[model samples]
Target: MKLKNIVISAVAALTLGSTLAEVGVGSKATVDAASINSTAQTYSYVGTSYLYKILKAAGITYNKFYKDNKITYRKGKPEGIVVHETADSGATAYNEAIFFNREWSNISAYVHAFVDDKQVIQMMTTKYGVWGAGAIANKRFIQVELAEVSTRAKFAKSVNNDAIYIARLLHQWNLKPNDAHYDGSGTIWSHYAVSKYLGGTDHTDPVGYFSKWGYTFSQFYQLIKYYYNLQGATTNTSSASSSSSKTSSSSKASSSSKASSSSKASSSSKTSASSSTSSNSTQAAKATVVKKTLKHNAYIYTSTGKRTKTLKRAGTTFTVTGTKTIKGRKYYHVGSNKYVVASNIDGTLRTLKHNAYVYDTVGFRKGTTVLKKGKRVRTYGGRVKIGKKYYYQTSVSTFVKAGNF
Candidate 1:
């Protein structure tokens, strides 16, 4: 038998305010079935139940055929109904079904219901998971996805329907009105919080859309608190676990003592080894003068004596007239008396060539580095490289190879 649709005018009075009071703030409101029919547009069918008939009789057209069609029932009493807003329109049932199926993949398929300004659709049984909540545990939750329309009037109507639908679900399940976000500490969550648990961040429904309507997170929290109280359940608090503090403190102290004793033994051994190593190094080497080559600031220098001075900026060669040792390694004075060793040279600097005298360009690179004027290199940690020229690492630096600048 076909279902009858009830259409209440937009100006209908809200007679459920007292009932809302009983549910508490943030709690779901309970409206009598008769009141729902009188104040809201309700569709009835001869054979179908009130819930199924009301959805089928809504104004929107439903696509009778779609792929991935399955219905599952939930197992326990519902905790709350989570509302979701689909940015897409629901002109055809086929498209709606497909969208619902795709979103239900990460979780079990069990959305309690779907609604739009004109119609409400039931895809899965209210008894099981509907692949809703993404990574959130939906064992005792009802998920309702609303089809958003383009017009503001329709949008307002959709919101009202969503609110009413949620209230009805709460009444039926005798559940609390507190919705849980996946990341919610105690109980209450959003799809965004749930996705975080599954290592996903793509889904940001319900909360995102609701916020556009001036709904704040705190407001939602208050609603949950109100509902929890109405349901005769106390809100979860951090101090609830304080009874076990003694055990936790005892365990912590025991672990700390063991760690402290082990650390002391290791510290004593390191101290003795460091003293012996320092003495051996002093006796190992005799003072010897040797000649060495040093490069500084992009200039090559030859030391004839033990004198440190800035090399003359004569092309790429700096002539050092000081007597020095060629023993281990020597640094060359480049430009203005700046002594720099060859070993200190960064190989990633394309401008610095072997045996070629180089000069420091700028203190740092600015902006981004473009390669071949096409590919852009990312600047991170104050370093940047462009073509054959290497820039210094600075606050204005763009990008450079590690240990190359």
Candidate 2:
């Protein structure tokens, strides 16, 4: 069978922050899965599964090494996530990442990331699409592959990593978690769901794999919802805090109201509250979006300063919303929990020393766009090595020889 190409840190802080907020909100995080006595119903959706509980407690460790491909979604943003299984019961996430990174073009299969018992290794940016599923599904959803594991504990850990990572991605993109329904109008999807509903491929993965452990896609969705709700809880807390502040300020003015007139004041206050909320929304629209060009090969990072993947070669441009200092190094804040070092970019201007042929990621000639000798064009930072020769990346897929510059 042809293998299917598959498809945080600020997320960690958000997880922790939400956990703390739940305490104040009178909500309790689920108990650890190990404490629950095992039963046939342990993995069912009637209640929180033992696996879900344990994953919530163990948390997730995120690692990213972006593959060279930079294909964006057809709509420029993914709508949801597709879950898959490697079917190769013995492969690890790292092993799969290595194999696919090299053979993706040859096999014509690639995914956004892979999940195993230990960590979630994201090889591609979810902001873009991969050739994992059929053309339709690839253009719409982010894809993830779960590595098959033998041991039960390892399986549990892998599922935990999978759910946590998916939940974070969903939250990052401001999307909701929904089961893949028959009408094909949901966010969370399985490869089988895509095969059956979307008609891109015939491979039925994860569904059969989940069956071996008496797990169902519905149950897995519950696990994703568990973490997704936690993220929403934290976000709600922030909104609530702002609301309370406004309420407190308003209450002070009403304190002088005569008790006889309290009824009339109640109606007035409700209208005033509505006006305040609208004003806040208008102010939020002022956030400035800043665009910058890379000066060198720069890594896109998490808010925590952990590197996710190296971006395109220097001189490539990126639009960022803001900037922040992580670990004392200033970083450009790209949306969806991504950051880039401020120093890696200055501008995107380069003068060609000689005429140069633009090559693809794998050294094949990409179309016929050639830079003329002494012509000035914007190029990105870093040298991309194709075979033994290195070239300067001029765009997401275009590269020119360093000798020509």
Q: Which candidate is the best by lDDT?
A: 2
TM-score of 2: 0.44
Candidate 1 vs. true structure, TM-score: 0.34
| Top model number, TM-score | 2
List per-candidate RMSD values in Å: 27.7, 21.3
Model 2 stretches with alpha carbons more than 4 Å out: 1-70, 235-405
Model 1 Cα shift for residue 330 (angstroms) = 99
Give candidate 2's total backbone clashes.
15
**Per-residue accuracy of model 2 over 1-405 as CA lDDT, tens digit each:** 126433301111112112212121111212223211121112211111122233345573222223455666777789999998887768887777767755667777878778886546677557778777788998899998889989766776577667767876786787998888334678998776676678857666675566565455666777677545533331011221111111110000001111010011111111111112331121111125644544335557776667764433333456656555554444556567776655444224578888888754333454577779889865544454543466665443345777898
TM-score of each: 0.34, 0.44
Q: What is the C-alpha lDDT of each candidate?
A: 0.33, 0.54
Report, for all candidates in order, the number of backbone clashes. Answer: 47, 15
Q: How well does model 1 score by local distance difference test?
A: 0.33
Error of 2 at 366 (Å): 39
